[model samples]
Target: MELERAVGTYLRHVALERGLSEHTVAAYRRDLDVYVEWLRARGIVDAEAVTPELVADFGAERASAEPPPAASSLARMQSSVRGLHRFLVREGRAETDPSGRLRPPKTPRRLPKALTIAQVDDLLDAAGPAPGSEDASAAQPASVRDRALLELLYATGARVSEIVQLDVDDVAQGDLLRVRGKGDKERVVPVGSYARAALDAYLTRVRPALAAKGRATPRLFLGVRGAPLSRQSTWLIIQAAAEGAGLTAHVSPHTLRHSFATHLLQGGADVRVVQELLGHASVATTQIYTHVSVDALRDVYATSHPRAR
Candidate 1:
């Protein structure tokens, strides 16, 4: 089979059948483009012409390129190539997977940065007036909505993409939120009181006003123009709150997620339970929070132990 045709088939399979997000599919496409071009340069346009040696050379060439790529980027690129060849072989379009022996470089394990509880409090406060305050009633529709957005982010430990994708009906179940996560997987997460109150305020008090400004939509969160809240807009909402709270550290939506998981683990929530709440397909992904908790314990021991240090 023509290598280009096989690549096209694999991309479509991943996007349509595997249900990968557009962003993820686009990354795979980019890496495959590079791989295809390199193969064409070597006068190899058929899938059967590919060899393990050629694939290994390609990996070495990418690894040794001037101004080297980050380990994660290199790994992802290699995975993209490997996935393509494997798919071709599995589909019987190729006799064997030439990229089988190609291995991604090991990436450094970086711990997620989580905010202290007080800092989260400050950030949430900066999002809007307190839920019961006189100012809460007077707060702008956007302010009420921003507060609800931040509160929900920490409450659910969901990805920003999942939060922005929520619809009005998705939150209708009292004290429970139906979150659609990666690959369209749905999970029910319990909503805390603070987030529920903020959501109620947004839904009853603010959302109707924002909804009136544009064409009818079922989206739970809306912009000043009443369009569905976008992921970029959601990020800006977090950034503005971080600035308002005088938080020096870089903050993003994932920071709230990390804090949610770390705090839960510190509070003695089981890692498997956290995994379920987080919609993590594997508990191994949730175990990283245990490391963050251990580090916190070490900090306390170093400070409180009188004979230490």
Candidate 2:
């Protein structure tokens, strides 16, 4: 069958019979379109003429090509082609699926970077402004907002999005915060005394001045125009704070989250409980930090023991 005709049939099957999402169908279409272009350039007109050897050759070509695709991208292409061939086989249009044995190129998983507890303390303390100097007015410095944000983020293990979107009502005394995570799921997390103090200062002094330009919008963290802070802005805030903290550690908002989880685990919190606190869908997702902790122990054993190598 012609590539065009077979692809049309496959798409109809995907959309109507299999009920695949539009985004997924679009990705499959893109992958198959590339295949069709390759076939046309080589003067190959029929799907039945395709072979596993040819498919394997194409995989190799893509792997060695300059600006080669990442494993995730290659995996998506393989999935799309495999699905198409499977469809053709089910209809008895092809003897076998040429794309069945394709494998994606390997991609190394990057470890999450975490801040040490002392480094975290230094970063948070360094977040606010330098006192006894600078600026025109008697207003509070911008770091007041950033200090509260970083403190709250570390204290509650709240996502940057959640922190930026939080309101005055979200915080309560006793160092507890009511955090709404992804998919509107809510969990109560303890905000350390430091976070509470930063929050108190911001609410009492800094936030009011920042919100002086407009009516209260119920967002605790407000921009100059009194709107709720955006996630991007929140990230920029963390990045700026990381720089100002003066120790060169490649830090991001997630680094604090990882630190929170690792510190909790190091202090003997159960892995399963950490999963629940982080709002992870499964315990497996939270197990990576345990691997980090284990590696640390091994390093200590290797270095400190007299007979260890």
How does each model score on lDDT? Answer: 0.93, 0.79
Which runs in model 1 stand beyond 4 Å of their true positions? 299-309
Q: What are the TM-scores, per candidate, against the unseen true structure?
A: 0.93, 0.65
lDDT of 1 by residue, 81-194 (tens): 999998988988888998889989999999999999999999998999869988887898788999999999999999998998899999999999999877878899999999
The superposed Cα distance between candidate 2 and the true structure at residue 40, in angstroms, equals 14
Question: Residue 78 lDDT in model 2?
Answer: 74
Tens digit of per-residue lDDT, candidate 2, span 38-123: 76787777999888987887778777778978878887887777888899999998888998789876667656678889899888
Q: Using lDDT as the measure, which candidate wins?
A: 1
Winning model by TM-score: 1
